[model samples]
Target: MRPPGGFPIVCHCLLLETPRGLCLVDTGFGIGEAAFGALPGYYRPLIRPVLSDAEAAHAQVTALGYDPRDVRDIVVTHLDADHAGGLRDFPWARVHLHAREHAAATRPATSADKGRYRAKQWAHGVDWMTYDDRGGETLFGLSAIRPLCGLPDLALVPLAGHSRGHSGVAVDTGSGWLLHAGDAYWFHGEVASPPHCPRTLALTQRMIATDHRERLENLARLRELPAEVRVFSAHDPRELDLAVS
Candidate 1:
């Protein structure tokens, strides 16, 4: 089938200028098709993403005249294959992620989450830097922000929901901030559309979730953020336009 402008889906990596070097939010598809483990049945009906050679994080950084090796940090939302897919491409970068998420992915309770990880995607050792819950630290009175310190302007927004350890990457863009909402919800319309979700998707998430209540609560929080904030989801390709570098 012809792609409907941005169909099937691909992840987006938010680039933030930092003091030490650049910080990458999440990696998109790897150099080739990522291998899938045993079928989830739900995954069977799906068509894989059409990775654009012209749109990868590595290529984009190179096109901007900066070397990919210069990227000093990579903050992951979670370790789902799609979210952690391109990690191997930038091996030299120090990775950051939620401690709960790191434990879940690297050491899951059951097979559901563990199955989502593909060995090829995470060739690098599991050494993601972890962030702890700060007692409601606020930025512009908004409680969803945390600092990246040595990395500068980038902040980690704890947006757990789609996965146990999932979090959002918030970048201060002078005028406002951009929030990368991982897989908190699939389509943008679902954010305020009465929280209705297909049974299959919801069930899979619940079964694999390390904390479902936290995820839904985070989604609620997203709805309440200031209008100046623009949120993006990993599966929502439309967001790429909003976050284009």
Candidate 2:
């Protein structure tokens, strides 16, 4: 489906300079994937990614003057190909994600799950540390799995709907909490009081959603979050611009 005119989507990832080592929240597409077309065939023609090696997370980490090996932990909101494609690039990093997400990607009980996840992205056998919502603290009335893999002030807030076991990574950035709402919503307006998403983008989200009703419910809850808690979507360029600026 064609996107709206002049409305660009982006793959936004967060790089954290933590006490232990560099921590990455959502690794975008990998350099090798871009060069060798590791992504599914339908993705290229539909998404039309820029496919720049420099845009890859590994390259960006290197450009920032840090050794790629220093990236010790990776927190993924989900195991979608675009989100986890950089796993091989940082082979040594411990990957942390929801247990259900890992199972969905690796086992793929449903056809949709099979299509949504790419095995080659994680075929190298990563050191995965999975968490469930059973035992965790609460954040703003939402259940959160905290201290992901022993990293302090980091939590995974379950916000499944776009995909089974999809979640938002919550980071305590010293100043306040910033929630990276991965694929939970596509546009900033989605969490507005009177939520408004572009028709094309809204349709796209609905088409890919594992549970459209639940997704909308989560979006509603996000809108009710306190103003101090910053929330942003994964693919909205406007949100990315606001974040960087």
* Worst-scoring 10-residue span by lDDT in model 1: 1-10
Report the C-alpha lDDT of model 1 over 122-236, residue by residue, as the tens digit.
6557456777776547754345446654755677777776777677877788888777878776656557646565555556556656678877777777777777887778775
> How well does candidate 1 match the true structure in TM-score terms?
0.80
Clashes by residue pair, model 2:
none
Model 1 lDDT vs. the true structure? 0.68
Instruction: Give TM-scores for every candidate, taking all chains together and pairing residue i with residue i.
Output: 0.80, 0.96
Highest TM-score scorer: 2
Candidate 2 has its poorest 10 consecutive residues by lDDT at 1-10
Alpha-carbon runs more than 4 Å astray in model 1: 1-7, 34-47, 51-54, 134-136, 140-145, 192-213
Cα lDDT tens digits, model 2, 1-245, are 12445567888999998888999999988877766656777888787777777889999999989899999999999988778888889999999999989999999999888888888888888999999988888898788998887698799999999999999999999999999999999889999878898888899899999999999998888999999999998899888899879
RMSD in Å for all candidates = 4.0, 1.5
